[model samples]
Target: MENERAVEPAGIRERLSGNEAVAIAIKQIHPDVFPAFPITPSTEIPQYFSSYVANGEVQTEFVPVESEHSAMSAAVGAQSAGARTMTATSSCGLALMWEELYIAASNRLPITLALVNRALSGPININCDHSDSMGARDAGWIQIYSENNQEAYDNFIQAVRIGEHKDVQLPVMVCQDGFITSHAVENIKLIEDSLVKDFVGEYTPENYLLNAKRPMSTGAYDVTSYYMEHKRQQAQAMKNAKRVALEVAKDFEKISGRSYGLFEEYKLDDADYAIVIINSAAGTAKDAIDKMRAEGKKVGLLKIRLFRPFPAEEIREALKNVKVLAVMDRCEGFNAYGGPLGAEVKGALYSLDNGPKVVNYIYGLGGRDVRVENVEEVFNELEKIDNSGELGEEYRYLSVRD
Candidate 1:
């Protein structure tokens, strides 16, 4: 299934932090509007982007709002007026935009949000965790998680196309682990400005408030009878996004020679034990899996990328063969059972009568470290469960103090 067209040469290599990489991508796209309120970790994104605006590098209208709510509100207004809009936020900042998040998605606005994942408040910590985006998982926006700076940049660029596609006109959240990827600098390859411009193309929305000839109303109060229908349509659009995301990734790979999929399967084909995880910890898990593989332990991993759509069927097929499984969550769902990701992965595998024995482990809350040794310990437990044929506690905590 190869295209005849020659792949474009790789883009220039650069050293950048996740925030800086994302800022560069936004500058290259030259989006119409960016209404943002600064938050820790994610604050650097708008900081860098605003500098571009001031330097005349990009003509994007950079609005410094008073709060995240105003940021999202302005984003909705700008997007409704037929502009390709975007914004950035983290943790409580994202929590503040909760209401407007649904508004933008329900209105079918393709607004891109560069989300730096952070732990939500109470104990008041600033670090890498999926609590921010995980809390907003059901908000109807398409969610894409990145593992590192390179992925953050690449995912943000692809988000524009995925969200704006006709069948999937929904807002998008391009997420990366706060501080872990956001503040950490790494070598990344960037697409050329002309290539990115041509790839994203023009933002010609079909029906907008600004269109004089096609006058229409948006965000009107929906009666109960129509509200359910509107919600149903939004759900269908989310379903459509799974296909659109893959399509966009194919095009992206053609141009950049970097392929992406719903999830990354690392040595999972014939493993006896596997771990299902997300975001930055996946890198650590991979190293652990490699070391275990050399020792002839049948261990592998499934790293989720597209979280909102959940890709349930695909995930089930990916992990169906494993005898024991560990699902890691960086946030506390506080359910006393496990976390959000554990819930989703378990639900995905529910129908399999002889599916892998699944164990949900809550780990790395408030930016606690996840080392290769820690991941290997998880695999060691899975091996024990496999050999003993006795399932222990289904819900557990990993690398947490007694």
Candidate 2:
């Protein structure tokens, strides 16, 4: 409590939208470069930052790029030259940067990405969904999802420290739901500028491409002989990221008074039925959980904040006591069995002697409303499975029109 008071001291309180909060964060951090192209739901991030540049509020070198691909390419180049770099995108914009995403990760650049989660195009969506970031799950970036504007701001600030950790030099994506948290105004507490600056510290790459004395090489083509070995190293770094992220979180908690873990467990201790979900939907589920708890339902929720480098062992331990569980996905897995969260959770518990009977529910794609009633229905489904000790169809859709 003393630490929190010392770190925050009732610091700047503001009613700012998620985009504006992120913009303010970037201005405070004042990275060396911000190369970006605009896209909906995410466009305001760069747009707001550009204003900071115009007003000389921050000395960040703003690079207006031609496309999202070019934006990412410029970031890679800037970071390779040993400059702190950041950018923002959503949906198709993130899709456009797909190729470069792997390159940035493989090269081990500590570029912080402000990603607004949005559904990918087909029928064309400009709304919140996990499809964009979920599609890039295996691309080897540290992914953090925020539930609200406060979390969005906090995550972006913490991302810098996480990505630049000495043991884990990897890119980090700070994601928030489009239009939901992104545009919605919320009350947020901000750490003073000097505190954030001191926390993020300096970006001193061990051996950058421009280190004349060290003479290091980046993005060198590797044949089969060394390719697998390099991938192994990247994998190890990702595993290291989990611990590093937690360490950073602990440090952050001292300042913000808001604690975080890999996932947040709500009323899971004595829960017989539970749902594991991500982002804004978790908020809705919590409301449903509360109402159900009032009626003695023993329903609970696991809200995942960190998605990539999936914390299998920890998650298994968290949900082990629950008799039945539903792993909800905002995007379709399209695998015919379960969504990504379900598949990963199932894989994590495969070796457990007694694990919850888990099912998958695809919901809230393309900005579809996931009300408290919808969440209640899922808990009811879990209750049915818990009582019967039998599983029905494994994968289902919620709130979808037939």
All candidates' lDDT scores? 0.94, 0.92
**TM-scores for every predicted model:** 0.98, 0.97
Candidate 2's C-alpha runs over 4 A off are: 1-8
lDDT of 1 by residue, 278-391 (tens): 999999999999999999998999999999899999999998899999999998898888899999999999999899898899999999999999999999999899889988
lDDT of 2 by residue, 1-402 (tens): 455534435668899999999999998899999999999999999999999999988889999989999999999999999999999999999999999999999999999999999999989989988999999999999999999999999999999999998888999999999999999999989988998898899899888878889997788999999999999999999999999889999998877777888999999999999999999888898999999999989988899998887999999899888889899999887788867888898999888888888889999999999999999999998888878888998899999889
Clash count of each predicted structure: 0, 0
Residue pairs in collision within model 1: none
TM-score top scorer: 1
What lDDT score goes with residue 218 in model 2? Answer: 83
